[model samples]
Target: MDLKPLLNKLEHYRSEKPNKVFTMYLNTDPADPDQQGGKWRLQLKNGLNNFESYLQEDGDSDEKRNYWAVKEKVENFMNENEMNLKKSVIIFATGDDDVWFADILQMPVKTAFFWEEEPVLDQLKEMQETFPKTGIILTQKDQIKYIDADLGTVNETNVYELDLDTEDWRLHQGTHKADSNLGSGGGKTSKKDEFYERFEANRYRWYKSIAPKLDKAAKNHGWERIYLVGESDEVNDLESHMNKTIEDKINKNLLDHEETKVLEEVL
Candidate 1:
């Protein structure tokens, strides 16, 4: 998920009263031993109670009422998304609903709570740093797949296949039609060899043709880092053609792997 707009909003937030914003980061990972019996529920309950009890003792009536309103909202959100919980949940809200942000993230987070004048964004900023907006280009032969990701999750995917007829790449959709020109039987091997030889001869030029397209994609999608994954020669040739600085290159063909597994292997 993109955090630029959200971070900008939170950074500029201003509440009429002190401690008006409520921020929460809860770890609800089921695999964690500390969370084995749905322990996050208990933690949530206790955390909310602690804030309410403290407000009851020292806060004015308005403060107490606002806290209660935010508390109820947070509880309702958790209840609605309880079944769909990921590794963690984050929220930032106010009594008047002037600012409300909530997300269930695939990555884990440290559990914490805060009632302050502005949103708590330390953890969020750290996550953004660790997993910034990235573009993963998986290239193999005449095909390329682009994976756009942010904050450790996939946002969009696109595939491009080279059109030998035009010597240019085109965005591919649905089932790709098989090549009808590859000779059958004994001539199949010869046709395949000839095709490979032609591709090898024009490899640099073909990659150069699409370099600008990839650069545009990175700019349009706000990719902070680029990764090229494929054979060493292909990756090196593609990197040489592109103007964007590649964060890294993996000499492994992962174009046909599952998205999740590819992420695990690359990131």
Candidate 2:
């Protein structure tokens, strides 16, 4: 889900013929943390050994040297960043002109090897399709934060913001002057009620302004779920104006928070 950059790198590698390239796979389950030499480490060694043997069988001395060099690089990489057992790993490494490019994917993949230009991306593509994206929308007053999330990996795809106070509502004296005049006439309503009434009206306008844009964005990105966060009353106010399709995707528990704080609490 957060693999956009990785995919772009692979696309650029399609035409590259490096000194050597290897696609390595390991079933990381039953993890070997710190890579303190455990089952995963053993699997890593075996996978590389098998790949080297395959390359050496019909390869020249130069090919053999490139294979070992890449092997050493991969070993060093694993040492630096230990593999997680919960997710499978598929690594792609290629070296040319003393420069190397490696793409590592930690996801569920069938344990196999592919010595090719790019790592096989079929599993990732499938996962993306299976798990439609998620959106987190936080609406309050004149500010709204819209975030796109990739729930499969708990990644934030994109974030956007909208502010609707081009002309400050607080600077408007007419409404307040009207309130003062009403008070002089012995109006029974509390000052709090008048302020709240104005606030609610603004809420309606803000909600109406953002609903169509949010709906279009959700549909365009094929979002399967949405996390609406705000006071329950305001959440209802905004959602009331949203397209029904978007409304249907809301979670049972509409989250509560002001802005980005909900990101920490929800996901």
For residues 206-267, what per-residue lDDT tens digits would candidate 2 score against the true structure?
Answer: 56776777787678756677767666676787788887344232333332232234444555
User: Candidate 1 residues 1-267, lDDT tens each?
Assistant: 899999999989977663399999999999999999999999999999998898878858888888888999999999999999878999999988888888988778999999988888999999899889999999888888888887667778888888888987888643243344344887889888887898899999999998899999999999999999999989999999999999999999998887656777889
In candidate 2, stretches whose alpha carbon ends up further than 4 angstroms from where it belongs are: 1-20, 25-38, 83-86, 97-107, 131-134, 138-145, 154-203, 210-248, 254-267
Worst 10 residues of 1 by lDDT: 174-183
Best by TM-score: 1
Q: Which stretches of candidate 1 lie over 4 Å from their true place?
A: 16-19, 173-194
**Total clashes for model 2:** 1
Return the TM-score for candidate 2, rounded to 2 decimals. Answer: 0.55
| Backbone clash numbers for all candidates listed | 0, 1
